[model samples]
Target chain A: MDYGWLMFCILLASWLGVELIAKIPSQLHTPLMSGTNAISGITLIGALVALAHTHEPLTEFLGYLGVFFSIINVFGGYWVTDRMLKMFNNKNNRK
Target chain B: MNTDIFYVISSILLIHGIKLLGKTATARKGNFISAFGMALAVAATLWQHPPQNILLTLTVALTGAYIGLLMAIKVQMTAMPEMVALFNGFGGMASVAVAIIEGIKLNYIPAIYYDTLIYFSLFTICLTLVVGGITFSGSLVAYGKLSRKLPTSSINFRGQEWVDVILFVLLLLSAYMWIFTHSVWSFYMLIALSFVGGCVFVLHIGGGDMPVIISLLNSLSGVAACAAGLILFNKVLIVAGCLVGTSGLILTLIMCKAMNRPVKKVLLGGFASISKNKQKSTRGTYKPISTEDAYYILEAAQTVAIVPGYGLAVAQAQHAVKDLAQKLTDNGADVFYAIHPVAGRMPGHMNILLAEADVDYDQMTELEPSNARFGNTDVAIVVGANDVVNPAAVENPDSPLYGMPILEVFNAKTVFVLKRGQGTGFSGLENELFFKDNVRMIYGDAKATLTQLSAEFKE
Candidate 1:
């Protein structure tokens, strides 16, 4: 299997995903983006695998970057999500 | 330079950050934990051989940082959800890009060890692309509806469900084919179908359920990243993705449970529609009060508790309500805010809105604590809120929200409700409290009515 072919498939899928999401209206973007961020946060798994396998200096370096970004994606994503969820708490005791 | 030291530091930051998020009082500290963790991770990465392409890395990091900072500073609390969706989309996009780069590089490695690694990378890349794409598009649509750029009702096109199902099946089939046959076309089709499925799924869902849907999508994105991380054999991505996915699933479930509905029911899109039917009721006989008369009563009251709702959000009356509360306090009246757990469109909506008005947090109490004292309250002021205070929840066993806890504002000595009209609440139920003998309907915009009440209190 040619590496370029695999890479093309990955790139194509990613571009499509981003473009489709971008086309959604602005109002839904937060939850939608938050959901996708959770998906992106899954990159943590990739970072872990990279850590386990990589011995080469270049591979180790990329693995480190992956780990850092993945952590940010997970932490920042959940924080924003929690904040958004808090927006629904209303204090109106009308009954 | 021990790599173990970096890992230990990062792990500690993550743990501390999570702890900070556990308590309401330490929420700000939680934000700091997140910042600290990211900084530590970045420092560790930089220390592991300075970036060869310093300009590229710095440029991307700076660009993302700038945009994020701008949004944090400029975005109103109301628009926070949409901003979250955008950021999530960016994260998924990033993962997909990384997976692709890794897939390309895998070709350069020897074919003997290629089967496992290349296949895993391919699978992850495709999964991330499809799921990420769908989440991105769906979130935008949700944002539009929430911001009123589009209507909040279900957009039911003919055969919408059938189309979505077909697309979903096709997406699965494509994934299957890609794994079995290793065909590029299968991968492309899978991506296309998944993207289309995302759009269709979100479009069919009504605005009321966007929060749950968004949370679910967030989980999906997390799983996608987890898969990618596994493909790349990156420990951090794996851990981070798993944590996010688990947390997201839990949050989504909690949101659904709070509504007292099943996840399937929420996803199916009929709840809000059923609510629409209940909105229309035979007109009941009830005396309404003018803003002036209500203001007079409020002015004479010794204790006032303000209950806010979606109406306040619509009227943008948080500031006015705060002002009213202050005036009541100044006039020797005890004032408190009673917050129901699920009052606004989402959880904690009222707190954020009121906080923006500089309302003292100490004066605000959760429903459980305040309800115990409602009978002693001289006047319970309800501003643009409904449902959560509905007496039907207590008396009607068949009621959708029956057995659900509510703020007993009706138990107060006098209840003054400020509303524009007798509109149904988010749950689509007519509030019996509106017609209670002790209740007075003060009709108008929340802000204006509160202003009137505040002026009278001052006099």
Candidate 2:
């Protein structure tokens, strides 16, 4: 079983899934994006797997780079998303 | 077994995070849950092969973390959509870079299957690169325009449509060469052509269509990511990218529907010119009112509902509005703010600006909830809002905003409109609400007029 073939299947499936979700109306987009961001969090798994496979110097270097950037994207994306939501909280409790 | 457990837990967290995003109340928690999941996934992956060279990895991680922190702390809420576009663009760019690097690395490889993969990768790479590059540069321009760092007016040159067509043809030709000849130089040329095409497309669009444009760019970014995901053989990337791409396209279509415009018409340009011509033809049909007369009516109204728009945003008059509301409240008149869903420059624009001025959130009601209350109100004070309150939406079938729900402020006992002049809104459509017998226009800067009205209320 070729991992490359498996990868292609996954890509096609994902693309189809995304297209299906995209067909939803405009009003649903913000919520959908919020949902998808969480889905993208799964990329961390790939980063980890990529890191684990490489004891070699170049693979290790790329793996580390992937690890570092993935962390920022994951954590930072979530943090900012949280703050943006707070803006809509409507907590009129301001004295 | 341990890795399997981590995967299960991470996947659950991701699902939970998405659930949280469903309601406005739980959106923050949803984001945190997802973030935590991502962090867990990263940790589990890294721990599986703990960087043998730990120092370099740690340094790189810390530096990236610091810059991200700075952006989070400093970037304004109004700029959120632009930032989202920027990040999506970066993701797309990253995918293109990865595909390019992979192609170069395998340039000398011996596998026929790898050659096919290279061809597919190159095609996706160019598609994503062109789209992503345009989205990136175009979004930056949008940010600048929204922030007032760049002019918001449409930058139309003579025969611009012809130029755009030529560029599109060139881009298509270059894409063909890259696909068939496998020429790297053609790929670079395609990149340049796409970037220029993006700039021209965005420049032709007016401020009114920004939300639609942002959503479109978002879709492009998603497609780019999916393409990149293919090159990397990553299931998560493929799934996530496709979701984003498809969602974006759907959103763009919805936005087009909302504006009563076709997606093809929007993409082809010249909307601003048509709108401008419409405005010119409709000018001078109604008599304009003075500030003093407008203030007299405002002074006497028993209940007033204030509707703010992009004009109020331009004047930064939220504080003045808050002051006016307080004065109205003190004068024994009931006052509330009517906020349209897509008002101001972005979603929740009026609410955010009003919040900055310390306006109580409870006093602000969304369009649907507030529209019902407007008819009973004695006066509707329209501050810089145009199309959202336009009577044309309710009455005219040929009107640009026909069939779309509006604030129905025209039904109030008296309608007091404060505007800079008789200038049209971002949509470039004439607001028939301005010409209504019950409506009176107060011409001046919204900030100045509101301040005067506040003073009169105090007196």
TM-score of 1: 0.77
Task: Please state the error at residue B345 of candidate 2 in Å.
Answer: 2.4
Q: Worst lDDT window (10 residues) for model 2 chain B?
A: B276-285
> True contacts preserved, each candidate?
0.14, 0.27
Cα shift from native, residue A94, model 2 (Å)? 8.1
Candidate 1 C-alpha lDDT tens digits along B189-223: 76567557666777677655666776776766666
Docking class of 2: acceptable
The superposed Cα distance between candidate 1 and the true structure at residue B152, in angstroms, equals: 1.7
Please identify model 2 stretches exceeding 4 Å from their true place: A1-77, A90-95, B1-12, B44-61, B78-81, B108-115, B276-296, B330-332, B355-373, B392-406, B429-432
lDDT value, residue B365 of candidate 1: 80
> Could you give the TM-score of chain B for each candidate, in order?
0.87, 0.83
For candidate 2, lDDT tens digit of each residue in A1-95?
25476566555654554445534422224434534532443443444454555555654555555455444544555656665556555452233
For model 1, what is the error of residue A58's alpha carbon versus the real structure, in angstroms, after optimal superposition?
22
